[model samples]
Target: MSKTDVSKKALLSVNDLCMYFDSAGRRIKAAEHVSFEINEGEVFGLVGESGSGKSSIGKCIIGLNRATSGSISFHGTELTGIKSRREYTEKMRDIQMIFQDPMSSLNPKKQVGQIIRDALKIQHIGKDAKERDKMAADAFRRVGIPVEYADRYPRSFSGGQRQRIGIARALAGKPKLVIADECIAALDASVQAQIVNMINEIKKETGTAFLFISHDLSMVRFLSDRIGVLHLGYLLETGTAEEIFREPMHPYTRKLLGAIPRCQCRILLRAANHSVRLSATTLR
Candidate 1:
């Protein structure tokens, strides 16, 4: 199904997700009472400034860091309540993460092909060694990376290429939900656009829901079906992309838009309008 026709089925839900840290005997509230739900086959963007707790929420969902309180559920199963090892393993396969820095996110020692194959093995996706190899090659091709370069290491590829490899690794697991935590922050402008377009294509083709965390509003506007504005550990506002851009309810949201360059702001507005038109035409 297309994004415009997305069903109301909730694929992931977070309620009162509060992640706190203690640094130097001081309590730091990274995220407080933040709540949102992602529907099946939807792209949900979480946009905020630096230190606004965007990555903290994504990390909490993926089990990198446990929340100090609150609950996170996937397909009605609370992440913290899984009683069986088998069930926990299933959950891990269902949700995958693409880290911010592709340079550091990948294994420096392994070949790019091996990296993807290793994930498939860990997730128990392919039946045999030959099958895993084929899947790994397919993953590389899917991300626009040449299969011939599979033997090369991550350090050998450019930043954009490395990010594509990271994406390939994430997709090799065939996850239902992927958390992209600032995945484009480290890339150049042209490469960032390419990755964004690639991600948009992946979402459309695979129907994989995404929690795209970023500080770039324009990129989020281009990618997100629904957006939640986060600031200083609180989710300030949420709505469809059209609503957030056309008529921002929160003052901070307006401030963010105002911060964009005038020419870029016009481009963003036009893009949003264009998206709305396309959606309407598709519905008709």
Candidate 2:
């Protein structure tokens, strides 16, 4: 890829994005004037405290929530403006999401393989039932699940295993980008490591861009190529993981970094070196 290619490459772009909601007859701004770009195969981390509008941005990107104002573009085409139904479907097929709770996200009534196949079917990935089943099996295997587990319900697997199923379902369509919105926050430390490692392996295999939304700065730094700090619905800082960690520019960013006790931080950062684990109490 040349510099020209790099300059022109962007999987998702947001400019002056504003999301507002009506609360008790008053207008509440969730995200205000937010602007950023997620490049091809880039893991752009959105870090913030509770109610900082981190999830709002992710939702807006995928059309889960409508934007109040401003522009959002995907692959250089305006998503917030206009598009045909087929065009929208084709573009959205390449975007997937892994929610925070696998249990809630996965249907209890459906078998694991069925769950993955639903995604494949939605994306029109496979030509027939046989091919779809094979795709589901391949997805399960890619995330380290035995093919037999596909027959079982979500209740049979542990939390980590369920999350892996969630990951497999998200990857079933071979998406170009994935939004992992606090996906690992609920898991234990060891399980967090497992999920993170699996995500890394899959990202390597697929060259997928990830909008990794989370409050864990340490973990975000570990998994993200570029990290953005959001405070009070504002983007306070954004740069490479090294730049953000080595020298944060904003006061809010500095305060978040300061929350880490130096000695404890060294240990925590060491664990984060493995690319998982919360390792922080407050990030708001």
Candidate 3:
């Protein structure tokens, strides 16, 4: 589809979604009445602390975990009671996930080329080994990996490079929606920036929608068109980055902003310290 067409479509929609677990004979709700919409070509950030149901919601949308009650519609089709393998495979082709830890997500024993080619083979896109190899190489190049490295194993590559491979795997299916769950958290700061930029470029080029789950508010502000804050399985607030940063309406959001180290008092203290240091240097 054209970029304009993608911009006009709502790729995924969730309504009153709830996921419950039966724990020790007591039912616990991991996600409670969560609802949101991710438009095609837009980045939606789901920010929350650990155990706030962020990953749970992602798993539900991806069909890894079953929802207790709620509706998830993808491309105008409801994702409930998908009975046939063909239907499931059709949905899988349109949606893919990039896991948090690259080291664990990839198979250590398999060659990087084989790992990436597996997705295409499963989807029946390529006819033979040679065709799959070419497809894998194309995906690797798209994610900035050198084609020669495709023969090496995941253990041979650095963390950042491994993450890039994971990204290439996710893109191999030509998915319309990518749920990136802490995709950059395991990398160093500099590497994280590089991967984030890569994701941005790919999103612009392919018009792929993203549901980015992270605790880094700064990164979320930079990448997301809209941000949602979750507190104990409840969506405390949802707004554009500017609105959430400048005029947070919820008490939880206000507390989060207040805790950020960029508050007025912290800035003033740093400025005062810098001024004192400069004065001492002048005296010397």
Q: Which prediction has the highest lDDT against the true structure?
A: 1
**lDDT tens digits, residue span 87-177, model 1:** 7777788899998998899899999999889888877888998999998888788899999999998889999999999999998877899
lDDT of each: 0.88, 0.83, 0.84
Report the C-alpha displacement of residue 182, candidate 1, in angstroms.
0.5
lDDT of 1: 0.88
Q: At residue 22, give the lDDT of candidate 1.
A: 92
Ranking by TM-score: 1, 2, 3
Model 1 worst lDDT run, 10 consecutive residues = 275-284
> Poorest 10 consecutive residues of model 3 by lDDT?
274-283
Who is ahead in TM-score, 1 or 3? 1
- Note each model's CA RMSD in angstroms: 7.8, 4.9, 8.1
- Per-residue lDDT tens digits for candidate 2, residues 1-284, read 22432674788889999999888999878899999888888888999877889998899988888899999988777888545676777778888999998778889999999988887887778899999999899888999999988899999999999999999988888888899999999999799988888887887788999999998777887788888888767888778878888988886676677555345867667544432223243231
User: What is the lDDT for 225 in model 2?
Assistant: 83
Per-model TM-score on C-alpha atoms: 0.88, 0.88, 0.87
Model 1: lDDT of residue 155 = 88
